[model samples]
Target: MSPIFMTLLLIVTLGVFAYTANRRWRLLMVGAADKRSDRVGDRVRATIEYAFAQKRMRRYPLAGIAHQVIFLGFLVLAIRSLILFSRGYVEDSSLILFAPHTVIGDVYSLLKDVFVVLVMLGTLVFFYYRLVVKLARMTLSTEGAIILGIIFVMMVADVVYDGAWINLRARAAGAEVTFSGWEPVGSVLALLFQDAGDGVLRCLAHVGFWTHTSLVLVFLNLLPRSKHFHVITAVPNVFLQNLTPRGRIAPIEDIEGKVEREETLGIKRIDQFSWKSILDFYTCTECGRCSDHCPATNTGKKLSPKHLTIDLRNFLYQHETALINPSRDRKGADAENAEYAKDLVDGVIDPEVLWACTSCRACETECPVFITYVDKIVDMRRYLVQERGEFPNELQTAFRSLETSMNPWGFSQDERGQWADGLNVPLISEKPDAEILFWVGCAPSFDERAKITTRATAQLLQRAGVEFAILGPEEQCTGDFARRAGNEFLFQTLAEANCGVLNGYNVKKIITTCPHCFNTLAHEYPDFGGNFEVIHHTEFLARLVREGKLVPKNRVERTIAFHDSCYLGRYNDVYDAPRDVLRAIPGVKLVEPEQTRDRGLCCGAGGAQMFKEEEPGDERVNHMRTEQLLATKPDAIASACPFCIRMLSDGLGDKERTDVEPLDVADVLLRSVEENVPAEQTAGA
Candidate 1:
């Protein structure tokens, strides 16, 4: 074959592949703008700092190093391949001609060979870690494994072909090229090829080269059709990811004050998801990052966020043709279109998996591709709760209670202020013009264990001379639990009622000790015209201490570990404020568990899981969290969320570990101040 002809053919082949791949990519990414607005500069900075730089990955040293090396090696090898192809066949030119075999080309070729070996080894290690060693519970479907294996084979074949070709060409020209200076493994192969007959060596070179090229082409074509589509979708998903409040639910607006009777509130089918969500499904690498971190999954519940995405993707692909041609009848279609409505309900997801999530956002936090698993799960919940009216028995009763009493526990709305009978708490209705409206959440107003936190917070506010008033009996449930449980209608009812009452009072700033209340009031209420500045009690206390309004004199000489609540820490990014409040007390040493900040494990209390019983599992989520906290062996375990406080306290009580007390962040702050500082100083400071 003529060298010039071969060069042109290769160029044409590459151009065809690139064009097809890019066209499909453009189509899939068409409506991404409506789902999420792009901030190019911020994304570029994050990509370089967090993704490519592996800043997040580096926290896990061994795995991080392995991944970083493989990623960087792929880039190096890609450039080397382009250089080799251009010099060997296409545009046959070399810088070495100026100096007649300069050392640079040889050095570049050697380094390329070395990196190829490194990449192959790294991939092999990952394969064993995922499959053989089973260090983690990795998802290895047949399709996924086949795609990975083909990519690995291509890497090996490319290096072998290059080495073999170099040896054959040198032999054909009757030049004695030393193999000793070449890369370790490739040098040995080159030496072996030197003694082979020219005819046999040339044939082997062609076979190796063709095999490498063919595999690359096959991989390219299969990418969009396989789970490996993440290779293309992952980067774009990361770039266009939601940067808004993670704790907040997306608002569903009433179109012209006319609710569409047939319209779905959350995702009922795959098509109903925002295009970004569809991209999220395609971009999941099935790395099990979410599964590993999920409280439900870790505790042996059926909900694996990674598997949820996989199932949704599989269902979409299975019905792709029918979905693309809606007018045409298919095997599963009913003559009267009866089966069309039942397709998603029966096909895409199991009822158990859909209901098992705690809406903890732990999955989304751990996912390297930035998949929004919580949003998708919540959407599915909305379908089941709003449209189908299907839910756990406990949740159904809770919904009824919320409808009647404006609380989930069936307590009388008039008696909601019973917990504050002896305490000096003011009602916002009476003191409607108060500076701060204390939104005492459902649990604290009712639950016995949580009431103490509320009273302490109120007393602390009074001591700080901060004028605050409560909604009293007029306050309704924030409906966070209902919304997270998938009752969008109920959520909207509760949100609108609460927004109306607050608006009537002209409330400007609100404060709450409950993380759930803080999240709902700060994030979701704005959707219903409740635009108050909301602060969690820990954040408020931290600020108070910083301003010298609250002073701590005594040092509690005990190791205290702070548990990051899912809503407060992962959902709202309020990890530091609670810790700051605790650390401000002299002699209080703060110890941290292994999972903190972005990777914090859930207490399994959010998503209305607190109201419903946990599914049968080897370990309870609270027990797992308690064990982690116990490992720190602190004198006390502190938390900001009432649900977390209750769960952890019960877990410890069950374990009969009375020595390690579970205290609300406010209680701990109060105790530390009570012991260290004189009452006069604490009151007047």
Candidate 2:
């Protein structure tokens, strides 16, 4: 009767689980193609480290530790769950090699008991977090609470079942057994049922056994329907993470073929999202870590990365049948006007939410499972900009400026060399023999504040006796802003044009003061067949300092907080080079912001935010970042990116603290280098 009953239950539970899983798999298959299976070894290693090891969770120590315990407990308990299931069919529940009373079984039983307690404690910690301490970073959902309750009950049920079995066995033998192999928790619990009647003992054992087995099935079915579905999808999601440099948005291939194929230039509908993106939506744990660290969300913007994933995931499910069953649609015109005909941007996600993103990758960095947020946001932006011609009006001026002059500021290309006028900077045309092409990015070329950084970098390069030439009148914006702002066509045009010019020059290597330009030229331009060695000015300067070609002399003493530009640090993993440059200088006490390096906040200038008016928010992103640097009370702030310098300077101005100067790493190094230079050499020729 027991074997028959358990088999029927198992079949029913497994059938439901398979049905739900198949539905999600079909939904995933409906998405556009994305190659996530390349590099098998790397994917497996990433899965082990990120998914199994829970590497990212360690950022929050207590929560991380608690999760580790719970995770391990689940893995360990899975075997025990199997054993318990088998006990319903067979007399003995232990594995074939390790039966009750054996050394292996005894050791396994002991470990299982220890973990059972630890798992309960782990759940208790979360209960305190949710119900008592109430951490704001965690999403408080009844679903989450109920899941917790279910886990707690599962543990209790397992304990009760074990204890009741022990009690019944001892009673049947008419003896008091001491320290049995599988009875650590059971022994302790058995004492309570020892004096109970035979009928009561049997009832307790039956109830406990049924509850534990039934709840396992309940939890299995709960996945794919709740945020907890991460347990099923997270490992696969982490394995499939984009392996390219984080900043490299895949270029649109065959941009001109859209008219003939009736294909939208960018993602216009849910079906256009990549399979990996759909996996990302399904894998989200709803931990709220992404939104917690997101500058946009923290400062009152409508973009919460967590909620964005949730919204998209919900929409994916809401139209799952509509998306997966295209064949079921009516014939003729109704086929074209399918069930999921509603627009996604304004229909599902608000425009305010879309434009508020800074593309900082903070959310991606914080996500434990490596789910990307920027790619999705940018893809949708591409749709709005290219297909619908519906985006923020401020972007129009930027697009117009970029279209006509190849710079967002509408500055004449003739003035690109003006910053280095006194220094007699060589143009690539005039000095085609130069080794390095100094790519003076748009801000450095046009923005007043950034021009100083450009000049400082130029002076340092000259002082170091390195032969570098600028593009001068031929230089164009790298189209970083346009691309990030969703104007991919403009970016592609600019990239191809710049590649042609660079190829004409036969340039081998390039250096830039802007992280944006460096990232674009180094990572994104390669897609346009413009592959060339590119380095950030900070890194080049750091290398020069290390090689003893450029020495920082004289104590231009000041405490400076080094701001990590998102493009340089997170996008390209170039964090230490800029700091190493600052550290090379004598009498420069380098301080770090509360938010620094991979965890650094954005300056409201990235994602083309500098080119457009900031979305409505309580506090500006740059000002918030400036405040973090200001909290250190440094003499000045030092940054590598020209954009960062401008944003931080503007932030300091807004706060009326001009005394806290914003200086580039190059500027600080230049101050020390020039102090020892001959006054005549520094002066005009």
Each prediction's TM-score against the native?
Answer: 0.86, 0.95
lDDT of 1 at 379: 74
Q: Candidate 1, which segments miss by more than 4 Å at Cα?
A: 1-33, 79-114, 141-149, 164-204, 255-260, 327-343, 429-433, 555-559, 586-589, 675-685
> What's the TM for model 2?
0.95
Sequence-dependent TM-score of model 1 = 0.86
**Cα distance off (Å), candidate 2, residue 118:** 1.5
Q: Give a tens-digit lDDT track for model 2, residues 1-685.
A: 1898899899999899999999999999988899877899988998899888899999988888888888888898888888888978874567674576788877777778888888899899889889998878778989999998888888899888877788778877887846654657878888767787778877887788888888988999998899989878888898889988788989888887874687887776777899889999999988999999999999999999999988888888988877777677523367556646566788788978888888889898999999998888888898889989988888998899899988987877777778888888988899999999999988888887788778888888998999999998898899998998889999999999999999999998999999999999999999998989998998899999999999888676789998999999989989999899888889999999988999999988888888888899899999999999999989889888888888898899889986787888888888777766442232111
Tens digit of per-residue lDDT, candidate 1, span 316-347: 55545444444663334462353323435446
Q: Rate the local accuracy (lDDT) of all candidates.
A: 0.76, 0.86
- Stretches off by above 4 angstroms in model 2 are 167-176, 180-183, 190-199, 330-332, 676-685
